[model samples]
Target: MARFLTLLVLLLAIDRAFACKPEQHFNANFSDTADQLSGTEAGNLATWVKSLQNDYSNHDLFVISSYVKNASQPGDSAERRTKWLKDFLVAAGEDENSIVSAGTQVYKPENFFYTKITPSTLIIEFVPGCPNPCCLGANPVKEK
Candidate 1:
């Protein structure tokens, strides 16, 4: 019995040692010309950001706004969307330091990885200190 207990302890320790942070992803979709985040979406993102701040260390939050590939717009709507997302993050108690970057990207079908491209989708990626092990390197590839 003692030997079995020792093995269990060792196994638990090993599991903890090899454990990696879970990937945190949040997304919000909007229309082509939309520049604001919905109340529910903003609230949910704020809650998630707060949780991540409490649970992890040396993590970063990235807000990437995806715009339609070939849409005609009078102004840079992507910038507006990014600003809205960052503002929501701030409202959720996230400081400016926690935000790694708020950028814009064009959505193409071929660039689909962990996210799906829509007219206007804001992707919030919470990256840990060591992102190499996140998703066990299965983010862009199928898990085998």
Candidate 2:
């Protein structure tokens, strides 16, 4: 029984690490400007995030922003883009803790299996995870 239980636990761990994939929500061409999000953009983003959270009440929320490398201005960088998004989300009444700022990375659509993608586009990916209190021994269960 001990050997069988050990094997089961190992298999389950492997499955969680490899078999389970994060559900990515793409906001293609979320922005044409690398500076900041417009009022409408911020509002829409907040509304969408909130709705998703409401629906997946048990899953944690994370935000990732990918921007066009060639579109950045002389003073612009990935960090700045991330800050812009974070500020916009905060201003829109989104809990800062709930938001994860994935620092600016090259907007590579090929990595996402897209052949044609716009320049200066920002892709926001939402990944689910266990919350703080439930981190230990808690399995992520997707809501219907």
Query: What TM-score quantifies how close candidate 2 is to the native fold?
Result: 0.55
> Worst 10-residue stretch by lDDT in candidate 1?
135-144
Q: Which regions of candidate 1 deviate over 4 angstroms? A: 1-22, 61-65, 71-75, 113-116, 129-144
* lDDT tens per residue, model 2, 42-126: 6777777677566554445657565555445442545566666667656655567877866555555567575444545566666
Residue-pair clashes per candidate, as listed?
A: 0, 0
Q: Which candidate leads in TM-score? A: 1
TM-score of each: 0.59, 0.55
RMSD of each: 8.5, 4.8
Cα lDDT over the full model 2: 0.60
